[model samples]
Target: MQHALTKVGPDYDVVVLGAGAGGMSAAIFAAMEGARVLLVERTEYLGGTTSYSAATTWIPLTRHAQAMGADDSRDKVSGFLDRAVGNHSSKSVRDAFVAAGTGVVDALEDKTDVKFRARPFHPDYLYELEGATSFGRALEPLPFDASALGKDLHLIRPPIPEFTILGGLMVDRDDIAHLMRIGKSAKSTAYSARLIGHYYLDKIRQGRGTRLVMGNALIGRMLLAARKLGVTILTETEALAFTTGPDGVTGVTLRQKDTERQIHVTGGLILASGGFARHPTMRADKLPQPLPEFSPSAPGHTGTLHDLAFTAGAYHGDTAAQPCFWAPVSHRKRADGSMAVFPHFVFDRSKPGIISVGRDGRRFVNESTSYHLFVSAMYAANKDGSHVPTYLIADAAALKKYGMGMIRPGGANIAPYLADGYLTEAATLDELAGKLGIDAAGLNDSVARMNAYARSGTDADFARGTTVYEKANGDPTHGPNPTLGPLETAPYYAVKLWPGDIGSAIGLVGDENAQLLRRDGSAIPGLYACGNDLQSIMGGVYPGPGITVGPAIVFGAIAARHAARRAVAARKGDAA
Candidate 1:
């Protein structure tokens, strides 16, 4: 039965705020253990970054990857994570995270109806990096029927249209191969062709012709699970404050439907309200580079719960926000007023003629590195009189093939630089500089040096020629290297690329049990934080696939299990 709008000291065993991937998993798992759970989200939608991220694949060294022979182990993964984030991470937190990660992911996959399978071929950031493993580690949710979610389907952001099938024909690996064999093996190809044709026809007849998958697919599955479990999803609902006492957290105060009310969750409260990314002032103050490209993350990640938790005497750690980890993209708006993420620059490596420069019109780090590294370099460059408005220079061919070479074609709102004519395009390098109001001569020198390196298949300044995948991803057509290309072509294009963050790396510091800790390294009773809200159990650097979601679910399960045990003890004491 539906409960009334009346405000009671509503009590639940567990209350999870934010229905993102982490929150959803936590809610569902907690419910399975007989906890009366309440899940609160600011948006009507369920999926968070998982819904918008290109991180379609999970990280390597995960349990999902190991079953597929990726040679990843908890110890190796732990080592890599420690090396990446350094000593700031507590041993307790790390050990607990590693201990529970595999069990959590496996539990979600097997216990819940979530349709996820290992995407065996997905590559790690650096295939050669220590603790880095090949295929079998990164898991992606297989596409759902969509007809299952029905109305709740719209709650998720749609996949970009262009990535869908060509000519309304859904083509898989077998279908594509069969089409190629059409002329040679008429009989054999005919069977495969008929199978493919029937597949598309059925999808079309069911109005499911335009199928989009990847990370969005995973999110859809999670939402379905959450919905089936009867999770109370309140979008546009904000938790304003916390109700706590000397024992621990009593409950939470939420402002919903323009009315403020307090709900008492007796079991536990989970703060999955995400980090502060859209808050311009907070981001500018915390992150190295203020302005970011398309944050595939939802807009409501303002660290509200973080503030509330601290005010309620809860401790937090790792407040330095982590910028978006993917490549930069410039979105172009469609007629429907929707935007598409253009991933050409990151995916298309043939255009080595392009270079990313800082505000000082100087070449910094390799433009093709991870967006995290790119932002770090931007921050470093800022110390040397580098300005905010940077430029991404490309010749005519690169522009034509890549379409201003954004992560997506559809335009989305980026800050500061977008307002200051940061995206300047021109036919000649001089004209481009004139448009950008920079030193025309300095621009030319940078271009000449870059082109020289491109021709010689060597990057003396930055050592860009070292990686095989880099050459494969950056240099598509050229022999030996794709990152090195001559920029002498006419009609150049320059679109500004900025480093935006997915969420902050900083949050509540917790022990191995995922228990919230005080500044003096003491545990706060009955309080815990995970996902982006925790002081990043991985320290600061992202490790393995599902780095964000993996620990989130793991710690959530850990917290829920601990909370359940505590409840049982409390109930026995009360009876006694």
Candidate 2:
């Protein structure tokens, strides 16, 4: 199955593997520094799993936060990390990230098409923690029009279909709000009409709507900037192995289509391949029982880069408390027979009238907690496999007002879901519990308790809405306790939930400069890592919204800068 080497390409100043936000940022930064760069992606499309994300980056004490009048500082962020992540993470790595994150954002905005706006209202996941803020730590990409990519649009990875509506119409937070109230208010109806009209108009000419939002927007803008910067992008080109010399990694063996070639790289190699979430053996070794089958990550994330880096003497960081970021996901078989998974992050669980229950039919944790914390609770309660497949139970009224899991709100067609076994429906709480194989008596009692809390606007069992983080995810329109609502209506429904991962936390060990480190703590020269390919600075703790992406972009810039400087030094040494 292997192809023989047929040709040797010209050497480049830098080589970047993968085409996600991190890799693209590295390539763009290197090229901007006047280094000839080659960016290779194994998949046909760029962006990788980031396209499926919300693309919000959480970097504290940034100039953006200061600009927004938020009282944040580097010392404060350091204090927060000390308490939130503790000694599990490297102080040097955290310091480097804090120093470089905001500068990277500013540099990209100045030199590339990338742009970001501070989210003044998004709170830290642990808002009560020391140094946590209620606003301005998170930055999201501004929406971008895919029409700017022209035919190149096909090269960028599209967002997940589950994140979109009407086949391919992209919607923002405002658009979602307007959509949810389309029939209830005239202003919302006008907003919907305008959005739909634009979508259709774009679809008429492009065959797909072109207004990309969220992570898609971030990737679209970066790709456009990469092209403009003259960075050479090679898609469907797989890096088979590294070509090392006495000094360090010198090049890579790449398989482009049917032909294999050796491409020399004088600067360095940056590994930003999406992590090992889809790797079978890796998952078995890293995760708890009943390994996750559904992930929001791209299928191209097979951990090939992790293996390749290991072969080059890079060691995976194994000291983190958790191996990967967790999320509760529900799966359904599409018409095409492929499975569709939806991560219950922000939309449904925190909204009024929904509660997650264990096999014994009792609420285990606050339903409005962060997705990572929610799954952590599931893991804590999985001592006897009783919580392996928890259920997200909601009443008919909640279903009609705010859908659960893959089901859309406002009476979306549930017949297909029920028929396909993705959903279970019953006219009464006891009946639903029986269908879900839970104790009917326990469920009835839990529902009765929830009804009392809903009426009183308080959650005594778990304090769901008391925290700033909980209230942030809760439906604002709902009065009293936005996160607490009664399950009094008949026709209860349930969706089975499983532990899922958004990305891997254990990856190549690297220093603050983004240089991969060997087992003995020695740097593997010419090899760098960022994104999920590098051990997370958060040390497996979910601190906030953009922890993964913020560090990814920052370290990407760090790697590029280091490589550029090293390349210059090498050239000077040769001249001497």
Candidate 3:
């Protein structure tokens, strides 16, 4: 049923599959080194799952941290990784990331418009771990104006609609605080006005807002850099299979629109496709127990490159204790029949007066834990499906103050959500428990215990606010233990939480040079894998905010440098 490729496309020195942060990094880096590069994406738009993320890059012992007076070193990072990642960690990869990461960041900032600033106060997930720092390791992309991309603005993937407000208006972490307090304070009102004014002005001119923040800004900057570097970006083009010669992989068979074409690559092939988050079979096989139904990854993240690589003799990494980064998500049916998933990372769970409960209506984990740890507890509690769909129960006061899931704070109208069945609300905790199919008496007892903790400022059950990590994400305005307030006010509200992944932790086995390895641990020539396509350096541990993306950009630069060198050597060999 396969059509023969009708034509041969022009050759390039290097070809990168997927136009995500990692892929874009590879393409730009290779092109910077004087390699003709082709960056191909199956989706019409650039940026993969990264376009929907916070876009924080967690590179340990970076110059940014040094500039911020953080006394982090490779030795300290190694100690932290040892404690966090345990025995299965890749030391060489970790070392490579630390060594090359700052250089890559600097390169991107110097050569392109992809600027970054240090989040000086961002805490690592396991802040109590040895060598973990409370500041200056994570780097966030600076907000970018999409107008810089000009006509190509439409090609950069937009942020998730669930993450945006007012259709297409984008906001950052600081801006969210402003919007939440828009009417309450003059400063907030001014911030909101300025944000909306800019949004409307951009909308009028280009039909979409130009001010991009977070992941959208990161991707937009990279796309602008790629275009500036004259990298050939092929959208809506999918790599079907690799064509090999006696030497190694020579080219790839591509499906472009209705036609199948062969595009040759002389240097190397870099696979930075955003892993298998959307691949059902892969998810079922790799993940523990019941597979996750919701993910924030792009639809193009269907393990296409993984499959192709496997067929070409690349070996998948050994399964980790946790095979994917976890999060709790609530979904709402959109007008177009698709679901809009909102990942509950911040803005609700760790706030005062909210607690997640299992079907038995008992707290199973510290509500202030990182989203990954929270879902890990969910997985552990899901032995008999009792915690498959845990409920994040909060009272009206909490809902009004901090919100829950997709619900806006400060008593925003929630009738639409209730009508759509995205949330369940009742006049009493027992009534809400009954509506959510949770044990009513158990729910009442748990709330009573929570209230006791709220008054005493101590979580006796799970020790919720015991750690600096937990307290960092908590409400500072709340008295005593900010993460341990009582869910005493009614009516009670509940959002159904299902297990979701940010990205796959399992990926192709690759060496320190970012070269894909075979079953026998031999490097596959001319093949490289970075980003989620390569096994996570943390061995599935979500140690910090940008763990997934930090290694991605670092290894992407490494892969490009290695590939470009190989290409140069090949050219010299040919000439000799």
Candidate 4:
């Protein structure tokens, strides 16, 4: 098998910008296919949001699910995705993803040490949504010793408290429960303990814990594989813009802390620098309603490619789809009067919990909806001029059942929320409303209506008491229905939540072959884009788990292959 040849100079076969999951994967895959590659990134670390994300699941209908007896296929996956964006995803992009999906998976499994398995418990965001498949499509990385990465792990982002690296990969809530269950059985407990011990040893040796890499693991494994193949990663270097000659992209101008150098890399340029998640101007112009929320991504995601690509006469589209939908969060005014906030607590209201109101307090939508749906609703609700942030009202019983108060159950991140009255507490509803600046009358009315729903086991107003899964996931302490609880109990607590986004979606437009497009619907010669830097083929909504990572890996590899092919073809044509 011919791998990408690495010959460092002003020219090569490919120059992949950004060391994010997609960029890294694209660089490695392209190199593996015999293209000399240069992986450039802005941050000191390699994982963009991949290293520091709550990526707990992978999506798609995959071999794992089929082996596990899940009836999933490429056709179903394609149909499901088609329904997601109202079938607007270009046939070319969809076809390319489908055709390359298996190859990408097989390449990683056979060529790299990234171990993965088909997990049974993970589910689609909407299991009932049309064309949705249950399991097998999403393959999760078996937890591996981060220690293998040595000092490289230190530069990588830590796991978000929302997730845990139990063995060497990311694990979800169901996995945690299974671990506990196994611990209860004598035979299972002993076996499980050994596995756990191995994970602990890996972490101890490597200075990190074992984890399940839902999507993040996929990226992690790919990067490790790429690094093993000798992909040259230049960190802390920002690609300012494309260096264009009379022909096209000639090289890249990079900034290295008070020093500007124009490195003329001859290989095809792959702009995967990520979308403008941090660009104030783009956020203001594109997402007018939600206002750009705080992104955990690095500061370098300023859409350099967008500006440079436009200047180079590249075509970009789908800038209107809000990629990262912010979850509910709250901010606190520090001593300096400035505020620092985070994606606040989204108490799973599928169970009997209270959706707190504002000064005019009201229950807006079904709280059980995913963060994306909730944020979209918030944008729609407040678009008419309501900016008051809402609170998620939880009773002490409910809080205890789901560990709702902590920043990730046991994490210490939200102690400040409890300390500064940001998390309001009261023993009574009326008193709570008074404390939270809500009109007592409005509060009483909403609660009465909600309580009535609780009694009848039906949410007449907003259908809060809707899905069985929602009720099953609700607080068990709440009688009969889990989601229709009236927070009329003592020791009631309220956490303020504002809309927050995961990251900006919608980026560079590319053809099915992963070639970046020109404004006139032509390909940008040898350029490609993937991940958040490329317009999300998902059309704004996260169709399933790993929506970002799946395409990222699939197309990152495709971009590399196509670029190498382009190089090969160019060489052949020149000879001819």
Candidate 5:
């Protein structure tokens, strides 16, 4: 249902720039606080890169933890973060995030449509750390009925094409097993029928399915909630500059297509623009040498707002370990001429019968480790130029059962993949190594060593299946070890992998209240930042799943709630 735009004054009370998870949540919180807000996006779609993601948030000490009996605590999380992050980021902001996690989550659950469910066994990435829990810190969005948005459903960014299947069916990773068994069992067959029927019906009506899951569901809920509160939403709008006055950033100058307008604000100016991951200048200045050419993230975070933001005395946080978070990506051109940068995030590497090898055809890092760690290993291994573009080796059976990069499971067409040169196929190990231009003898030796390891049920080289997190991603039914298996299946397959920076780890430094700060540590009044615009709380260390989104939502709430309170206080003073 559409309502007339709510307004506290002539123009607006607050203006939220950027429509990612953080910015969207900020607008909703401001609106709930009785402030008329305008949510703006430079692109036509609202979800940003998050809609292309799994939409998990790593927030500790919530009721979800209690419900799952996760045995997690604030102190445990704090200790782990301290050990993992050290002084890479501001401790004050980190502590603030912990203190407000439960409150923000509870409020969203009780007062808004946004909802989350705990995964009982999704362990933190750094599971070896003392403060790490086996489960419950990570919360995922529940599936959403996108038809609730009616015609506005398209306003949300669609999922990445590579993440979907059968034209546009967005199936969960767990549900994929049931889909593969369509006719094998009665229950699976019925489930597959309903899912396929629902997708086709939705496609017939809206040109795309509306059963939103993962990050899209989360974005949809926020969009619907923002609309329910009469928040004005504008897409294809760009923020030019900030308008300042005695009350600080009083408003923003914006341009929509051909039109230009300056709207003064009575409340706050929130900057949640994704981040500088794609900015050429930032990439050169912040990232390491031999710069990456591909990113799996959405194209919105080009650091477009940073230059304008610097004019207001805001500067980048200087203490991060690296400028951006990482993942080893494999890219291929699609039939539509679009490039698909597939992130190898625990599908094939962690599974049995696959191993990542450098140019010398030797194992480099634990193939089953987290994506961030995998890329970091790539960077480390490439120092001597041996592994910049590593090759992931898997047998034909493994490729069919688990699927390589850019190829989904359920026996997808390997012929097309081979025809496109995205996947290299050969009948023998020596021939496979010859095609990849790697050492064939070394490849033979590596496979023989792997076969011995499989028989012994141990990864003597990198201990691939040692950790709980790695095992969680591995095949549980496999005998001996879940992640340890011989590459004995004939006809090997290979895909080239490159280091891909997924998102920026650095952003404008802010306080616990999510207010942007000057160099001297004083606050930039009425100027706030969240999402990637705000410096990550973990300080660039990949601690676990949902690290980016966890603090994003928490601080977005802090910024909006604080600004709303300030607006109310100012109104009271004027009345007095």
Candidate 6:
């Protein structure tokens, strides 16, 4: 973390609320510019939903992509986004994110320990569209050793319980691949053994596994960078209101622990506090009809900052195609009396021998499409709410191999899941339809058509495996088509899928510089927002993996760059 400032801050030049991807990046970028910074998190943990994410940063034109031979350009991406996002968002603001994305990644890698590697094969979610490619564009954060965080390790939010295994071991893509090939290949066996061995050793030395992967690793790297930069971080701190001067926001009123105090700010107050996913008022107003009962987003984003920002003359963007990014989710009650809401983000739905149908027992959308599209399809099909709580039907063989929703793969004992009513099992297709209240004839016909598609390698009804992304997520070893298969095995299984918002898409409107905008279109001086706190540049369109985190880093950097420049000018003014 060279060239980063070691300045302590009583009167900080930049103060960022929220320790998620955007806020942490803003704090680090400003600190690297020698700006005294204060990073405040209401929760004790450093990462929000980002820590629970796969940390696939969707930034194009980065050196990682170039080195990996990614055939992409700014114009090509612009064209694709223009079609995909259209007039749903501010084109200029979206352009700003695209332009600054590569530079933001470069700055973090060059000036700090934060590092990212682009995968050789990652498709844009909408692969059928023109200007789309099968590889590059999506970058993933390198796995980090959490021990490097030392005593601050616990400050990182734990991964979703359903996502981790072996009592808390977080695994990467490679690790998962190896684990799946256990006993089938000698090399895979050895790799899996070593990985499991390390996890146990980590558990012995640390309460949790020290080998951080995915979102945890991304957050760990940033947390480490913030520490090295000497950015002041106060956790369990609640932001009450913004204290402003004639020029702009001058400070923030905070309740840290048991004490309430106001801190001075010399540059700006940055808002990256997740979104309104958990806010009751915002949910009622912004979310879709029937109002989803579950959400997989991090608990920290309660829209407190958005409300506070309203007092600072900030307004929310209303042009988005949708208010929140959605996912088809399934939930089950845990032994602890808490419900576990799991977003079905590409594990089972696309795999062989599975079909998602509305209550009418007919397929509604491409089963292998992106999670956002899947949920959007749910909403479209359930205009009257009857089609919602759709059923994901899978046979016993598929359930054992791919696992549906909260079910684990390769597990023979579905007794617990069945007993808890998380899964409904039946020995016959007609019996399964009856259990799920599906039309037996429609369900039977749909399954027969799917079986026909499996044999012919073509999805006549829904075009399941036609796109690059669909095939990429499907089981490659399967029949004529990877994502198409017959659901004829005995003892069928079903899980109820509900539309769950993964993150808020609508947020405070901001300029290209990441500065908040007023109702009359003037920039609100001294206030900036990024992450979900800022309106989604995609306008509720889930373009590719890491779309959220990618923009979070970019706009955070934009805000930091402007804030740091302002701080330098202010110092010159004071000196003169």
Which numbered prediction scores highest in lDDT against the true structure?
6
lDDT tens digits, residue span 1-576, model 2: 111235334688889898888998898899888888888888888998888889988877666788889988889888888788887788889999998887888889988899989876999998879998888889989999879889878787877787789988888897898998888999999989988999999888988788888888999899899889888888888899998878788889898879878888888999988777677788789887777777877877788888888888998887777889989999988888888888999888888888999999999999999999899999999898889789999999998888888788776788999998999999988889888999888788888898899899988899889889899888888868888888878889999999989988888899999999988999988999989999999888998898888888888889998997788888889899
TM-score of each: 0.82, 0.97, 0.97, 0.85, 0.97, 0.97
- Shift of residue 523 alpha carbon in model 1, Å: 2.3
Better of 5 and 6 by TM-score: 6
| Lowest lDDT block of 10, candidate 2 | 1-10
Whole-model lDDT per candidate:
0.63, 0.86, 0.86, 0.66, 0.86, 0.89
lDDT, model 3, position 147: 87
Off by over 4 Å in 6: 1-10
lDDT of 5 by residue, 1-576 (tens): 222223223367778889989999899899989987888888888898889899998889999999988787788988889988989998878989999999999989998899999987889888888988888899999999899899889988899888887888887766687888988989999988888899999999998999999889999998988998888888888888888766678788888777678887777888988998878788788887688988888888879888888988899998998778899999999888989899998888888888889999999899889999898888888888888899999987888788888876644667888898999999999999999999998888888888888889898889888888989878898858888778988899999999898788899999989999999998988889999999888888899999988888888889998887777777788799
lDDT for residue 338 in candidate 2, whole number 0-100: 80
Q: Please give the lDDT score at residue 210 for candidate 6.
A: 89
Give the distance in Å from residue 436's predicted Cα in candidate 2 to where it truly belongs: 1.0
What digit string (tens of lDDT, one per residue) describes model 4 on residues 462-533?
666454334444655667676666555567777776776666567788888777788788777666788877
- Which tens-of-lDDT digit does each residue in 1-576 have in candidate 6? 211112223477999999999999999999999999888888878899999999888888899888988888999998889989999999999899889988899899999989998777899999988988777789898999878887789889999898998878898889888998999999999998988899899888888898899999999999999999988887888889999768888888878656777778878999988988788899998898889999887899999999999998999999999899988999998889888999999999999999988877888999999999999989888876757899999987899888888777885678999898889999998999999998888888888999899999999888899988999989999978999989988889999999999888999999999999999999888899999999999999998888899999899999998988888888899999
lDDT over C-alpha atoms for residue 563 of model 6: 87
RMSD of each: 5.3, 2.4, 2.6, 4.6, 2.0, 2.5
lDDT of 3 by residue, 329-444 (tens): 99989999988988999678888899999999999998888999999999999988999899999898999988888887776889998998888999998789878889998899
The superposed Cα distance between candidate 3 and the true structure at residue 54, in angstroms, equals 0.9
Can you list the residue pairs that collide in candidate 5? Answer: none
Q: How accurate is candidate 3 locally (lDDT)?
A: 0.86
Candidate 5 C-alpha RMSD relative to the actual structure: 2.0
Residue lDDT tens for model 1, 1-576:
112225334667777887666677677877777676777777666667666654343434456665676776778766766666566567667777776766776777777766556754554545446765545656666655566766566676544454444433434334545665677898757866676665577566554432335556666677777667766566667888888788788778887676777887766777776665555565666555445546545666787677777776666565333533433444555457766444433543334777777655668877656555555666667675464445778776665544344322222332332344444557788888887776777788888898888778888877774554355456456744677777876877677655446656767777776667778877766676666777776555554445677677677777776665665666678799
After superposition, the stretches of candidate 4 with alpha carbons farther than 4 Å from their true spots are 1-8, 56-59, 161-216, 245-247, 258-261, 265-267, 319-323, 331-349, 356-358, 405-416, 465-488, 573-576
